[model samples]
Target: MSKQASAAIWLWLAVAVFVLDIATKQLAEMLLVYAQPVEILPVLNFTLLYNPGAAFSFLADQSGWQRWFFTAIKLAVSIMLIVWITRLPRTLLWLPAALALILGGALGNLFDRVLFGHVIDFISVHWQNAYFPAFNLADSAISIGAVMMVVDVIRETWHDWRQRR
Candidate 1:
């Protein structure tokens, strides 16, 4: 595909994912009470929580400095990703798409952080009573996209190595 077409596709995908993420988060906020856990299965649950910090609640207990810090970081990262995506090679659609997913997800959470001082998380999973932290669709998409990008990179490296041998 042409570079313009590739960039356009990634841009559209990012917008779609961002919209879905925001809609789902809105639904969670409307339907669930803060920190109220609702079991979906033996190993899965929904529990609303607001994260004011980065992943795993980093700096969650800080005296508010972390909030703006994370917000600024996310904003910078989102802008950088957009620029990087535009310059990406047309054949590396997977990498750009992955970056777009991460960008969209980051923006989704950043919106919450800016508007509500935290991120809205609701989906939860556990084993027995050992509960995993609550998360949302955007986080899942980012994680999946990152994993795929890593896989793609590893495969490409291996291919290059074989060709060089």
Candidate 2:
């Protein structure tokens, strides 16, 4: 059988995501005032914020070791994903796409953490007095990619069970 194309081709998607995330973050910073909300809807606003730690501001209050810690983790994860994507067959689209997204997002946030000492977050979601943690395009991409990966695993498991039945 002819060798199938490797999913490394999907790395382009990762590049696109990374570029877009960076562009949007820059634009948000330029257009939005820090900590000042620009309401776009009843539940959504653009409010510039910086995250020095991982999700939900975890370890943000620490003296500052978490930056390098998260940076190391992101580097490791991005490298592993690149290798895995290269080994996967292009016919397996969802998993590769998911990996690419995650790689892009990781790089985006890593760029911010290294250059600015924090991740730029501008998208705010709220319900009256309750507000969700501020996040950016990179965070959204990572979240979507993670959800896709979980769904793909569930699908594969179900397929395997059905095949055995």
Candidate 3:
């Protein structure tokens, strides 16, 4: 594809996300006490944590294999997203941006998994006696990206339906 037409141009977003995620994680590590909640609001806190497994601590109770298992998955997914982004049309905005976010988030967590054998999570949200799973900026990026993908699909489907009428 021509340089001007390559969707790879969106990769700058991925790099931005990665750098921001790493920087925030480092700050959290340096400033927050592990497993202790530093209240930011009535429903939000910064609680440093190390998640040794996938989202929601899946496979967390396992011996030690989950570390490398998740690492491999993250690495593979990052590569696939990069390739997909490259193949997309530059004119397509949302899809490429979403892919870049996911790619960046995956690499961010993969960095932690490879170096620390765990992913650092700090942001915490709770209400009364209930608590949501703690997550980091990387997770936020991935979730937002996934939501964007769903929104794009819905929009496209709606457009197609309208054209058939």
Residue range 117-149, candidate 3, lDDT tens digits: 999999999997799999999999999999999
Better candidate by lDDT, 1 or 2:
2
Q: Which residue pairs show collisions in model 2?
A: none
Residue range 1-165, candidate 2, lDDT tens digits: 238789899999899889999999999989999999999999999999999989999999988899999999999999999999999997899999999999999999999999998999999999998999999988998999999999999999999999999
**Can you give the lDDT of residue 139 in candidate 2?**
90
Q: Which stretches of candidate 2 lie over 4 Å from their true place?
A: 1-3
Total backbone collisions, model 2:
0
The C-alpha stretches of model 3 lying farther than 4 A from their native spots are 1-4
TM-score of each: 0.93, 0.97, 0.97
Name model 1 segments beyond 4 Å from true.
1-6
Measured on C-alpha atoms, candidate 1 has an lDDT of: 0.85
Model 1 residue 112 lDDT? 89
| Poorest 10 consecutive residues by lDDT, candidate 2 | 1-10
**Cα lDDT, model 2, residue 47:** 97
Give the higher-lDDT candidate: 1 or 3.
3
